[model samples]
Target chain A: MNRLVLQAQILELTAIRYTPAGLPALDLVLKHESQVDEAGAHRKVALEIKAVAIGDVVRRVQALGLAGCSVFTGFLSAQKQGRGTVFHITGLES
Target chain B: MNRLVLQAQILELTAIRYTPAGLPALDLVLKHESQVDEAGAHRKVALEIKAVAIGDVVRRVQALGLAGCSVFTGFLSAQKQGRGTVFHITGLES
Candidate 1:
């Protein structure tokens, strides 16, 4: 039961690369901003997250080209060789 | 559409504190471990995320303590004075 549904804009994107298994992978940074209700008060929330898209979703994300906001469905995992987390994208909705 | 539902165990918990606004707040670290299907391959995923419970949910999380795994529903926000993100817990399911 690890799932994340986020609506954000692609703030930065890198060239598509291939994994060791030859799967296409795209890395990007996403910027999210919204107002949320917390402790009975409305709060403005904003953050940027690092995300990656692999396999079939890579092509779709490439086509989008950081044009507008999109809803992304994914799971979070630790960076393979780093100190932070990465959102592994599995689905996308423009 | 910013939501995250994760099942994880509480790795570390801080004593309940009060916010400047007088709302109760509890901070904790969550460790998540699972197997996920990605790019047509099964991958083992594990991550430790910092999370916080405020308002009414703080009491519930305090009662649960670090006993076992639980599902948490929340939103991600940037750390107020840091570079990373924090999970703001809103709901819990044991």
Candidate 2:
């Protein structure tokens, strides 16, 4: 079995490009459906985050918040175009 | 217990600002150390990819690769500044 890890639930999301002032703009949207942890019961959370890296993108993501998640890295043996890393998320509607 | 997913391995990295050619510049670097699968024997891969999102970033990440992995979304109740979503990953050199 592949070595897996623990990730939480994803919720509603929105993204915005970072501005000169510094705050990132929320310009993206996503459909969510995942599992999460509440006070006690194992309630499913709403949104999830997932990404890939080969250079510093991954590390940058982690530095942002390396908490509970199962990140992955892979390559397209086909095109070989997407070298470095390719990540995704689980949970969410799927 | 929080709901989690199956992430893969992360690898070495190198990023550069995208060019006119239209390749998102890979301008970053990261460490590797994780697990993977090959035919049968359970082998730990040597890389992991992780990231966070809010707005269009998360959707962008997933649109890239919506595979087997545990992604999460959360908020820093403290700041409320990092609202929208915050994701991270495991399987890396935590």
Candidate 3:
């Protein structure tokens, strides 16, 4: 079971592109900030992560635009040919 | 509203250390592999992520050792001095 639920703002977006299989895809960066309790102490946490939305989720994300924050449900995967991770978005709650 | 739940194997581990505030900390890498449904297709997902366990969680992780997999509950954070992300582990289920 691998899942990540994040409430984040769309920080940056790229133009829609088509995969080799002809599926619609969008790439974006997500900024997340929240106060969390860890080790019995409250701490401020923030981050910006690269994410990708494919197929149906891409249209919803485009409609939502980048004006507000949304909750994204997804899983993490290593880049196809890189040393970092990317969030593969499957669902969105705006 | 940021949370990540992943079942992963401990791929690498560093020696336990202490923060300036004297809190115990441990750094490690986790490898996750699963088959997920995405955009109407069954996809294989795998990733190796850098993670940290602090305070009470550190001891528990050490006790669990690296022989088996565990479910980790955590949040993602930007690296303190880098361009990548790190998983800040808050809880572990063996």
Candidate 4:
């Protein structure tokens, strides 16, 4: 099980691209800021993550503006062979 | 809301440290491998994330051997100085 639920602002959006299989892909950067409970204390948290959306979700989010705040549900995977992690957006709720 | 639920192996563990406020802290690396459904397709996902645990959770995880799999619940935050993200572990379920 690998799931991430984040409400973040759309910081930047890259132009849509296509995979070798011709699937539409979109990449964006997300900025998240929130207060979270941890170990019986509330902490202020902030993060910036690079995210990618594929196929229909790509078009859906592209049609919608990449502005303001939205909740993204996805799984995290490596960006390439064995390095950094990238959030793969599968669902978006504005 | 910033929540991440991941079932991953404890790949590496660092010595327990203390925060500025004297809170017990532990840092670890987690490797996750799983199949997730996205865009109507099943995709294999794998990620290696750096995580930190504080207070009692640090002691609890420190007491247990970090040799097997465990489910972690946490929120993502910048590692330091607004740079890369780090998982802040708050709970563990083995």
Residues A1-94, candidate 2: write the lDDT tens digits.
2222323322222333453444333211122344543222243444433332222232333333423233232221111243223222211211
Give me the iRMSD of candidate 4, please: 1.1
Clashes of each: 0, 43, 0, 0
Clashing pairs in 1: none
For each candidate, what TM-score against the reference? Answer: 0.96, 0.22, 0.95, 0.92
True contacts kept of each: 0.73, 0.14, 0.81, 0.84
For model 4, how does the per-residue alpha-carbon lDDT over B1-94 read when each residue is reduced to its tens digit? 8999999888888888998878899989999999998777788988888989998899777765576578898889987854667989898876
Model 1 misplaced regions, further than 4 Å = none
Candidate 4 ranges with C-alpha deviation above 4 Å: none
In terms of lDDT, which candidate is stronger, 1 or 2?
1
Worst 10 residues of 4 chain A by lDDT: A60-69
Model 3: residue A75 alpha-carbon error in angstroms: 0.4
Which pairs clash (backbone N, Cα, C closer than 3 Å) in model 3? none
* Candidate 1 positional error at A13, Å: 0.5
Model 3 agreement with the true structure over B1-94: per-residue lDDT tens digits: 8899999999988889998768899999999999998889998998999999989899888877775579999999899998789999999866
Q: For residues A33-61, what per-residue lDDT tens digits would candidate 1 score against the true structure? A: 99988889899999999999999999888
lDDT of 2 by residue, B4-91 (tens): 2333322222332443443342211123344543222233444333333322233333333433233232211111243233223222
Query: What's the residue-level lDDT of B83 in candidate 4?
Result: 61
Model 4's CAPRI class?
Answer: medium
Alpha-carbon RMSD, each predicted model = 1.1, 18.9, 1.2, 1.7
Q: What share of the true interface contacts does candidate 3 keep?
A: 0.81
